[model samples]
Target: MSVATGNPVFETVGGDASAATVTPTGRTTAGSLADLAAQVVTNTTDAGTAKANAVSALNTANSAAAQATEALSQASKAITSSSANIAGGYAALDGSGNANVPGNMAVGASNSGARSFSIGHTGLKDWIRFQFYTGTGVAANPDFVFIGMNGTGNTDGTCALQGTAFQPLSSNTMTLGSSNNAWSGITSQTAVDVISDLNDKNIIGTLGNATYADVTAKLRVVWASISGVVYTLKSGQSGRQHIGVIAQYVAAAFKAEGLDAADFGVWCSTPKKQIVTKAVDGQKIMSIEPVYETDGKTQETQETIRYAELLSLGLFCEKLERADLEARVAALESKSTSSTAA
Candidate 1:
């Protein structure tokens, strides 16, 4: 029965709203304040599940990233320490697990008139140091050194040496050249016969390494310095290119799940690029930000979630520490729910 405005003491209800009924179980109601509590609990439960799922996904990504990073590291180490042959040469290695070169290589010569010598190691690396010298046994400049791969089947490797011209060798050993900027086009080579031939002619050039490993380690350093990952970004364009690539992968996953492009509120733009939220106008849904804020705009929130994830990735990618990342994700998920409740 329904209660009227004039009825204050009448009770004929057999439903959950009955106050006179005494039962072993708790009373239930179709419309009560407890429903709001239940809704809040449900939303919280959903967020919790989403958070757990996100953390799981992040863990997967991080695990993959860690595997990739480890693989790269192993590759680098192998390049430095592999006894495995490349183009008929052994892997150069040093005492500290670093790669090195062979011994008995000479650097400078006491001859006059544009003396150029080539210094290199077998396998593992391609560039060499070219020392210039003059007559009268005087070094015009010990700071000028040339680096490049020796061309095959030619005198001094097709005369591939750069000519900046310098003085003669003072001692019989090589010295540091200019510390300014190094020359490029060093190319790539991995032939033992060619490198050994260079060494036999006193063109191998003497280095400071006491052992073959030290020599190879030094050569590896030069190689990385000459060739490493670099980038340039356009004006107003954040360095989101890398993230954009990753996000594209994320987007494909999102679409595969059949998520609506509108109504549910999804905003994924390259950082620094203008963000446009998607919305619906009656029956017409456009994939652009509404011109009018009062025209019922989508509620948006910029979170540090990605940042936390990134930091987590950076911290655990190279190493194997999942506990830390899990803790951080948990804290973030807690904060997100707490804020929603507030």
Candidate 2:
């Protein structure tokens, strides 16, 4: 398209430059081109600034990522350290780490210059305590004395010495039973000695050659030696009944092994009473005697007859009584038959 002007124009023969000078309404000027060049430069500068800003943001993001990775590594190390401490604490409490505590261990409330190692139940009322004294004179030893306390929470607990053999503390008495108790074992040497002494003193002549009449006469002498005196138990004494024949009487009766009814009758004639005294307490106390070697004449510290001997004597007496009754019946029947025949 060509611009139109009001000025008259001469028609140019094909491509001729003879056109009158025409003033064009629209034309490109130097100032407008300059403005367009400035706009292009401004756009390029803005695009460059935007690209630079994007690059800067990418660098900032990379730095942030690096810092986060470092922080995560530090946190992992801290967690591992904390876990190790926790594991150590657990080991200490359970005796898994310390050799001093071979089993379970617990620390009680601390007192001045004192501490207690406890085992068993955690309740303060019922626990076994290993107490170490820090005072003077034999207290510095780390070996603890064992103490057993119960929920009663009184001073009525027991303390034992810490040793290979568990023994009660000094001056502490251990009772076997609340009342009567039984023990099974050979009598002690001291008891044997006491019995030997008694046997020697109460020696009735041997019954080897003695007839039934002689046995009866010897038993009388043996019975007379004992003094039977009835006495009441003093206050605070054990309420157990003390009923037993004198040891000498039982011993002499045992010696009359093959006695007839008449001899047994003499043996039974001995008065029954509290003939035993405190002096013969051990001898009369029913117990099995220990067996030992003895010379023929001397009463050595050897085995003597026990309660079973007394029982045997009792059986003998019963047999003798039964034989006597049968004999009396036979005599009576023989008399009746003789009378009927007459």
Candidate 3:
């Protein structure tokens, strides 16, 4: 285009010169078209880059979510395992990175570590067991009762008794007698010598025969050190020894109330005064009754986990099954996809 100065020498378009030289119609510029094409390409590239960035962000977020789910699954399994250990009737390693049952089995002197044991019913034997706490001079207490109720008199038929039984001693060492009897003097006893003495002496009356029907029996050991630590042996039994002189009261109550084995649940807790009160109410046994009848503080030294604890554990396992953590993760992934598509 040329200035409207009537200059014929200046032409605007189509190789034609006119007086209206300012006209801009019917024209094309190589430089301006090239610039426009460049702008369009730049816009397309920027949009593609933005989409790629969004995808990268989404991938990172999805990875984080997966990690979180995995962590939760691991934690869930850990909790379930711990609960199972507790329900199994042996003090488990505490969550504090320590393996030990609490209460009387608590960390003892010279015993830098805790023991772990399990209990199960074999035939007519119904019993609960705990890890044997080992230490020096823990055996033989003047006030402790160490009697083994040998229903079958084998390693399996052994049960802890709260009552005293006469044990025949060949010499200074006692031997498991062929017949059932009681011994009167066992003050401080450790786990090692307790069961051996009972087995060899055969002091328990039920030796060579089954005492209770369909029961769980465990090796028994009850001890009180001069220092006031009471160690009880956990072995198989009908769990009848769970009742001391009060056995009749417990049995009668269960029968009168029509309470069955299902009604009474076993659990171990910290021992204390009025221990029996801790037993489930109306479940039959009102509280914890020692396998042995003893005075004051010794009663406080014994603790048991309840059968209810096991019942609760079963419920927890059921929850884990329903959660189906794997399924949940899959569902979360699908949802993320749908959202990103939108």
Q: Which one wins by lDDT: 1 or 3?
A: 1
lDDT of 3 by residue, 213-245 (tens): 112111110001001223333654443333222
Tell me the TM-score of each prediction against the true structure.
0.17, 0.25, 0.21
TM-score of 2: 0.25
What TM-score would you give candidate 1 relative to the actual structure? 0.17
Per-residue lDDT value at 145 in model 3: 42
lDDT of 1 by residue, 1-342 (tens): 554433233334554543332222233433343454566699999999999999999999999999999999898766433344343446455558854344344454433223345355445245556664534546566444565665553444533444554435664455332112223224446632212355456433233334544543343332222212234445435664323223333334335445321212222432221224344443323233323234445433221123333333234332323554788899999999999999
Q: Give stretches of model 1 more than 4 Å off.
A: 1-36, 39-45, 48-52, 55-66, 69-77, 80-342
> What lDDT score goes with residue 240 in model 2?
49
lDDT of each: 0.44, 0.47, 0.43
Quote the lDDT for 200 in model 3.
Answer: 75
Ranking by lDDT: 2, 1, 3
